[model samples]
Target chain A: MKPTFRASMAWLHTWSGLVIGWLLLAITLAGTLSVFRPEISSWMRPELHGRLTDADTATQAAIGWLTAHAAHAPAWYLEAPSPRTPFTYAVWEDGTSYAQHALDPKTGAPDVLRDTLGGEFFFRFHFELQLPYPWGRLIAAVAALALVLILLTGIVAHKRIFLDFFTFRPGKGQRSWLDAHNLLGVVALPFHLMIAFTGAITLANMIMPWGLTTLYKQDFSALTHDFSPATIEREASGKPGSLTAFGPLLADVRHHFAPNGLARITVTNPSDSNAVITFNAIPSVSGVGVENHTLSYDGITGKLLAEHRETRPVMGFYRFLYGLHVAYFAPYVTRWLYFLSGLSLAALICTGLQLWTSKRCHRQQGLGFKLVERLNIGMMMGTPTAFAGYFIANRVLPPFLANRAQMEVRAVFCIWAAILLFAMVRRPNAAWRETLAISSLTCLIISLIGGIPHSPIEWAVSLVSLGIAVLMRYAMRYTPYRKKQS
Target chain B: MLLPLSFIGLLAVCLLAAATPRQASELFTPPLPHKQQILIRAFGFLLLAASFFVGSLSHNAGRLLIAHIGLLGLYAAIISLGCTLCLHNKKRRDPAKRRNNHT
Candidate 1:
């Protein structure tokens, strides 16, 4: 119990990281997968499983569809398809309830994706921990900040972190674990630093809102209105106005973008005479920076009225950081890099948890140690298997059932709960082997289950699952259960 | 195409790092003099990093910087695993030689 700096930091790193490490694993895995949110959404909806469409035409088609079907909505947001995303994604409010669906650009028909959340579940889960709104975001902020603290303390505690970055001595139990932990932690140091900071800063608005709160008297609406792009504003005319052709408007906006073109087109009060069409531009390049430019047009006349440009550097900085976190700028190859780094993060967290017992206490029957071991197996193995169950549920669930999406979400938790119970009751070693084997099987067979389309996305995902299976299989050999038998 | 090329360059760089006297000695390879090894390693790293810009600026540059760094880290991990496997194989076949070399 010496009160030395490194010792204090070591103690701090262990406890803080342990308590929040589960949360970190959950978020990191989901956040990594969230890199391909659009692709995942596309894959989940088999109805839209076809060749890609032209962006301009897709925008027009989406507009046409929304004009007819989404007229009841106060406004409609339509994102034109891209290389990675297959369709025109649309979102709008339906009498206080919100609705979002992906539409085929050619047909303007929404695909039959079971009301499942798909990748959005992961994306939202990343920042909000899937909790309700502000509270989820608050918890995410605390978790991210804790990660930042653990990383900083870890850097301080390890003297040879940089020198040992290349060292890895396997087959030496505790030594191997330490080396693996240090190597992964140090090699991905910059990434861990940037991701943790950016994640927290992205929620800085929620965590530290005093500045904005003071300026706008807690009216976030007013604060956003000032910086927001100008849009056409009008009271309801009570008379309906037919929308003009969206093709020319989309073409007009194409000139503004290089390589890539219009991203989203929104229609406000589509049925009213004062209806307006807002064309939002996306960056052509596959990297990060805010490209949320807005060009508002009179819906009836199809004439451009207002243009909103980026003028604030503060907002630009935040968007850059946000873009880094979400990785919307990454192409497919780069996306894999993000996913791999994210897995490294999860590995680091997992190793840290293992070291808590492996390096410290013995294999005692103490309740705390047993509980931690059970929780570790339950989370590390159970979470991924739960996702496998989710994907399977998305395929098997009756598409027409009411609250189908809710059922899909429930499937994840149900599978997770069942596995947790199993992990608690069974020996930890046996639990690990059984859960991983089930995960491997689920991932190995999802696409083979008839009706699910086998796209390149599915293939990429399958390769990852295969990698997980191999790792888990190798891990099964390391369990002390077999060692005891021998 | 660019991704694979980058990966190859990275693998070659890792192999070169393992070829260096300090690293080679640890991996059961003959230890050469340290002369110019540092320079060679730096040059190798530079060549690998330069590959990022060779094909398309948009492919690996700009917003993809984090992804670029992540890939490098992953390559490092793979290299570490490879080195560990090499050491393990050497130890299994001739434990006396490994002990003598270390001593």
Candidate 2:
């Protein structure tokens, strides 16, 4: 006999959500934090330079510093901040190797800046979890697809959906928990769907570029050309060549975009006379987190050749979608609201997982119930342990260590993996309480140690993060466990 | 599961009342009395419709006025249908007949 449509959808929703719930929870929560990553970084580095610096002076100083450091470098990648961020950061590659540093605002000196890891680490962790490039990202992308399916099935299977919205009847056992879950889910449904869809689309080319592959055919170079028009170089010859100078190029960009600042610069086909120089124009719109443009110049003559602005109909729409999803362009109020909603969504997933385990435990299911109980603990508590490890790595690890980012990320995964493995061996409740307590204490103590150098404001942020960590541990201690019937 | 599911169900009902204002489902679900069902549905519908009208009217006076009118009409239709359901339930079980059934 065929099951009813609702029954079929219910099964789909339950299984789909459960299978990828932890992954989705991690990705979404990390992504929410990443939306405010830049601000957090700024807050973390209070001992750095002041809030503002002159752009022209900083650029010239950085170029001069790079010339002195690596005079015969093949290429220099200069990344100057927009108005929002007033620091000069750059990297350069010579024939042998590449190096990166933040410029001192006053002295314009390199290597003076502290080696404190900033928001970029969080940004990288959000998508890749610091895993090996495309593979980790691929796993996350698959999880996103599963999330989309779960949300769709959830909506379809929800009965009396309207009656459920304002119906948080506490202390009604499963009914109360379900009501809270549904309320949170529906309240943030638009955000959840939008973020998942847009996040998938952000790496659209990586996931499915069939359309591009078909259109561009074997001339795949044209795709890069079309997207990054600024990357075009002069036709090559059998003759050797070398780039002239970047001074005039910088001057030209300054004249063209007077009020708006220059965000970044790219040198294509460097060490060739016919190399291309691209000066990315600063966006005029304030608070829209993205900053990229294409203004190509002749590398030999340093003449402004052409400008390809993508902030138009189709591309603009894509940017808008990304902006909405990331909340990069949002004000303080909207960003906090987004953060709160993301926390609520995490709570919803946690409670739902608990509800499933509780029901199964009551039936005296042996190994299966134990496995679920352990997984719930490992996922919920283990994630915080991993996050604390990341902070610890940043503080203790040598700043000049090669591949520091990767190492910090490895520390997180190792801790998380160990906890998961331990959960499998140990009793669920004992491991849960211990891991939660350890993670909370680690975070709190680290915050105090790492935040002492900064001002009261930074201390407060650290305190808040630490407080949340402790609260989570407390919640774990109170969670009910299975009883043995006499 | 039961707790979260029912909350979601109630929320959906309230939102539907707000969004459509005129569409009411005919099925007698949730094991509630006919009169109580009609009253709750009508109240939800009218309240949502009114809030929508007032909010839009105050925010974007010119265009929202038209929106409010349309919403008001929708509320009227839904409330009427809900009232019909109440009457049908009453007809199904007369008070005198109820006494006989009990006896």
Candidate 3:
């Protein structure tokens, strides 16, 4: 007999989710961590802590350093220090390659700190999967699409979604797992849908480039110019020229925008007579949009050249989708909500994976079933343990060690692999408990020796790590291994 | 202001949960009457709308809307867990009451 509509949906939901569930969890968890990327980066670079400088001073100092070190570069990019991040980040092309430095806000010198990717690693890994360009993003985009499909199918299959909104019965094994899964999925349904859909939209250009190919015809520069018409492109005149003082120009821009609205500054042909400086505004918080308002000035004369604001509806909508995905404009309360909702989505996926295994636990299991069972335990607990290992490695490794950043990332994968192998060798119940204990212990160790937090963001991160350790400890004790063993 | 708005959202979600017949039975000794349940559900929805209206008065209505939805979900989860614990406790006590009567 053919399956009913709901049954077919249930089948699709189960298979689609199971196929990419582990990858999706990793992506979601990393994305959640990325929500606090700036904070994490600041915490990792202890040398930059407690030293605050105004944006104007930092920008000038960074420019001075770049002028001395990279004068031959055609252009330079500068990110002013903000409350969240205390370092002035500068990037410039040096001959054939790009060089980046985190400058001390007070002195404009390259920060004397351990080299590490810090939170940027998680941000990149969330969408890029630590793979080379295009492939990781493509894979993540496909996984996001699959997640949307799974969510829709799960909604269709669960007929009592609304009726059982407030229902949960724990300690009943499989039934309990199903209830928890449904509860997590249904409670944050809108957020899950919004995040998945916006995530795909953010990478839509790469995922669906047929339109670009047909319209732009391989001229990427034309596409960029069309997308951002405010961008000024002028070749260097070759005649040596000096830049005008940045103080007056910055003050002028601040008068037009908010005091902190100027987020990035781009200097093109900084040593040429045709030099131009552009200031990009912060993402808009007043509405559901990203207004890429820009002001351009003649670098030599410091005279305003052009001012542009995003007004086209289609482009505005696109920017809004991108803005929503990144949440660049979120305030403190909203940011916390985004973080919690993200974790709830991860929890939803984890519970769904557990439900899949629990439903089949009593059956005559095949190799596939056994493999999935072990994998479910390994990936769910092992991934977080690996993340904690990354933090631990950051503190334990020698400060000036060569390839220190790579070593920290390697520690994550090494720990994850070890946990996966250990899970494969142990009983499922024991594997779960041992992995939880290890994860908890790693977090506890971080809290003990991660150094006293020098700022509010660092303090929050430290406290959160301690909180996770406590929760993991509770989970380790609460796991029903003892009853099953008896 | 956001704190009070979130509290209102939490109260609204609790009312809506209590209006559900199954949850009402678990939460109350005798389930609320059908007419009262309807009133409570309507009031719950009205409160949600009122909270949204008040929250949108801020300069950034979009941000408030997103945060409001997230907070509502959190409140619902908390209420669901609380109800589950309450029901478990009641179930545990009912058997003791029956045993005492038999004795």
Candidate 4:
């Protein structure tokens, strides 16, 4: 009458995974795409393709533009072009007003590129789900916690995890699905655990804010300030002043922070006498923690003020966890590994969902069974189709259309919604095959529309899209039209 | 460095898989003997350690470890697929074997 430990774990694993599986898949896939955020951003802006400029020249040009356009702004931010990104990202804020522009690295002019979120859409959607602040992050955090639980329960329930580490029996229906699930889960167990745990930790402040509430007591800014204390906080003198030359300051930063180029530049009160300029070092591959090594200079005099490096142990640990999750410091090969591991996690969830439905295939179908079957088909195929739609929208939309970026994102959701509705209306097997066929076609169209790649990143993206098309076509052929009743 | 590590990791995982009786049967006519299985597994573990050692020579040990784990998963999956293909081909080539398996 009582369930054994393994049975309880199995029950928990099945229900928990089924409940949050779709959300986890979306988050994982988005995060995976975010691994190449800069590259994707570059690909989306074909106008900037193959453009290269020295960081100092880009910085000076961006500053010159800002000086002309946003002289009255209190602060200006500049992200210099890097090997992966070919454009300077510049932003200016003046209390109530804010603006951003992608500057041509060579000319410092506003690049006449279609306004799109580019890879940032995927990066933000990973945790935010494109929802309003806090809520989406909260939901993502809860899903991550659920994933950790599901993975742990799965490990407990899978008594043959080690034995089946290298076992996969394809085309055996439920058994094959279960085998694939177990194989993927067991092999990538460490990565799954790390990603889930780190994901939760990344948003732990929101989910578990008791400490913040007790200490800061609604003064969130104070908490943030304490975490990263400003090296120089100077009030604007309001007296007009010209900024000192950036070349020598940049040279000094390079000389001091050798082997690490400047990643970001912040100018506070740029046109005021008390202005401060700070340059942040690009993260190096030598450390697991993101070292916020910065050099500050008096903006008016261009004299070096202070140098700061992250030295606090607690902050170092937190940065380490965050760094692992973001993989900002990852090398080329390591980034590919992260991407593959992310795919494996997504595949593991897919296999688990399919196994749930296939296990009860022979039983009398109930409403719950039907819903799960339809949803599984919709989400597994529909999400990727939606992603492809987003890419297609980027190329197809009018370059200067109003709200073009929002329209592209809307296209993703609309396509996904339509496919979900279609899945519900069509037979389960037919839904799977049709969605797969549609996904394949969309991918093929993307590859063709993308045309010849101008950069290595573009080439990789094009080839990958084409590869997915081929794979989807192959899968479409194999997906059975009718279920074989035992 | 990473390429060599990947090669060694793949070989290591294949050996471990071959030591498993079920997978071994798919790859070999007769499953490997118990003693040989143990030896193969030991060698596999040794190579796996070597891969980790080589990987740790990189600037960051933590990142290297993460990469190593990812590579392990990839290698295991490759071996699993390889074994599955081997079994499928054997069953197709030997009709009697396929008939016996069906029965």
Per-model C-alpha lDDT, please? Answer: 0.75, 0.63, 0.85, 0.85
lDDT of 1 by residue, B9-98 (tens): 686557555655546567654554465566666676676666565534555456445555676777778887777777778768787877
Interface quality of candidate 2 as DockQ: 0.04
Model 1 agreement with the true structure over A1-486: per-residue lDDT tens digits: 748999999889989988999888888888877888887776676655564577666766777777777786778887777766757778899887888777766867665444667788888888887678899999999888999999999998887753465788876667877898898898788789888999999888788988887889967557655766555656668898888877777777776555656677778888888888877677536547656577888989988888877668887887778777777677677777777788889899988887776764445458888898889888988888887787788878887678887898899889989988999999877787888777777776664553343678777666666677677777766756324433
True contacts kept of 3: 0.74
Residues B1-103 of candidate 2 have per-residue lDDT tens digits of 2223223344434544433312233333334454565777677566555554454445334223322332333333344345445646755667778799999
Candidate 4 chain A least-lDDT 10 residues: A477-486
Model 3 residue runs over 4 Å out of place are: A94-97, A451-454, A480-486
DockQ values, each candidate = 0.45, 0.04, 0.76, 0.67
By TM-score, highest first, what's the ranking? 3, 4, 1, 2
Candidate number achieving the greatest TM-score relative to the actual structure:
3
> Distance (Å) between predicted and true CA of A221, model 2?
2.8
lDDT of 1: 0.75
Tens-place lDDT digits, model 4, residues B1-103: 6677788998898889888767765668777777898899899999999989888877667777777788888778787888888888887889986778999
Give the worst 10-residue stretch by lDDT in candidate 4 chain B: B21-30
Q: Which ten residues in a row have the lowest lDDT in candidate 3 chain A?
A: A477-486
lDDT tens string, model 3, A121-196?
8999999999999999999999989988999999999999767888999888888888999999998898899999
Model 4 clash number: 0
Write the number of the candidate with greater TM-score, choosing between 2 and 3: 3
- TM-score per prediction, in order, is 0.89, 0.75, 0.95, 0.94
Candidate 2 Cα errors over 4 Å, as ranges: A43-52, A70-78, A91-110, A114-117, A169-173, A234-261, A269-272, A282-292, A366-368, A398-403, A451-460, A483-486, B1-103
Name the lDDT value of residue A475 in candidate 2. Answer: 66
Instruction: For residues A105-187, write the lDDT of model 4, one tens digit per residue.
Output: 76677647667888889999999999998899999999989998999999999997656768888878888888989988988
Better of 1 and 3 by TM-score: 3
